[model samples]
Target: MAHLLSVNAGRGRPADYTDAALTGIDKRPVAGPVAVAAPGGPTGTAGSGVAGDVIGDLRDHGGDDQAVYAYAREDLDLWQAELGRELSNGVFGENLTTSGLDVNGALIGERWRIGADLVLEVTSARIPCRTFAGWLAERGWVRRFTQVARPGAYLRVIEPGRIEAGDRVEVVLRPEHDVTVEVLFRALTTQAELLPRTLAAGEALNVLSAERIRRRLERMNGVPS
Candidate 1:
């Protein structure tokens, strides 16, 4: 049974990049009821487009689609075996941490509703970038992440609502398409054979990140990369 394992949010004071170069920001648990938006809906302070747009941009910047951040449930042992180190208490920067969710295996376009308020659409998986690499305080943390756990999905809010720790999350839709987050991640990063299918799924989501993937796939096939 899938369960909400833990919920975390950035509590570290917003980094004043101009004032000082902050190497890493710490994440802590937060009260629930996070924000969400719809297509052509109001985008929050992040200044993208809609809520999905925000998620799409984040994906471009290396964030996962639904499982934006994740922490293992079997204590720190899983992290040690997978991440090569124990997750320090309150370390993994994730908005909602869950258990029993094979988030990586979750099909793209799946939806999960939380607490009757927030509706999350599984979009894609975490693609490590410089920010994540810096977060781990290692030069090759991104490569290590890809080689190790493969992390989870990043979610776009389908409806606006408050989410809190301990809220029950129910899967609303399981994708019928073969495209999964892992497949999309590989399509975007490694030039997989299923890249065309992954791009088609991304286009169905109508996300800019997906458009980028589609373009990349086209180029890779000698149609245009």
Candidate 2:
């Protein structure tokens, strides 16, 4: 059974220091089986509960999905190859580290029931940001990350519940379209032309991504700048 290898959380002003400090946050045991809920549901309050909603709150602040991260079981080695020297705590800043799951391939609007308490839906991929570049101390780390691991994903809770380490995570739903996290990531960052097409496909993209695609279509059609 696929389970959460670990779970992490933190709160801080966005900046270079924040990324460095996230290294020390402690990971604890999730009670077991958490539930995910829709945005604005009782369990989805931005400041309350297990910080999933808190991340959603940050999104409200205009923070893009880059503020969060998810990593696949297989790519853990790749991350180590890139940033192993900087990872003294032996954990990445990702809020969730999962095993036996390929999150990048999960469809948007798809639901993942973690353990029994928490439910997470694949909403979007975490686009690399300058903060990540600062963490890597590389000028092009953001582009490099996009080109390399394609990372894991960003999620929103569909139900609220306690999530701790070692909880089992299973896919409750998958997207009907073939668009994957890697596809979306590539479309959004490297291949600008595909943005509209990927958006048109609209199989697994989160709300923000969908909006971005719509905007691209508008621009391509010369409706507005």
What is candidate 2's lDDT per residue for 1-225, written digit by digit as tens?
A: 777776655444344434332222232323444333333422122322344323323432223222234666556666667665534221444667777888777766667887666766666766765455554576577777878746567776666676666878888887676667777777777777767547534544556677777777687788886
Candidate 1 stretches greater than 4 Å from native: 11-25, 32-77, 82-84, 88-90, 200-208, 223-225
What RMSD, rounded to one decimal, does every model reach?
5.1, 4.9
Quality of model 2 by C-alpha lDDT: 0.57
TM per model? 0.73, 0.74
**Model 2 TM-score?**
0.74
User: Highest lDDT: which candidate?
Assistant: 2
lDDT score for residue 160 of model 1: 61
Per-prediction backbone clash count:
15, 19
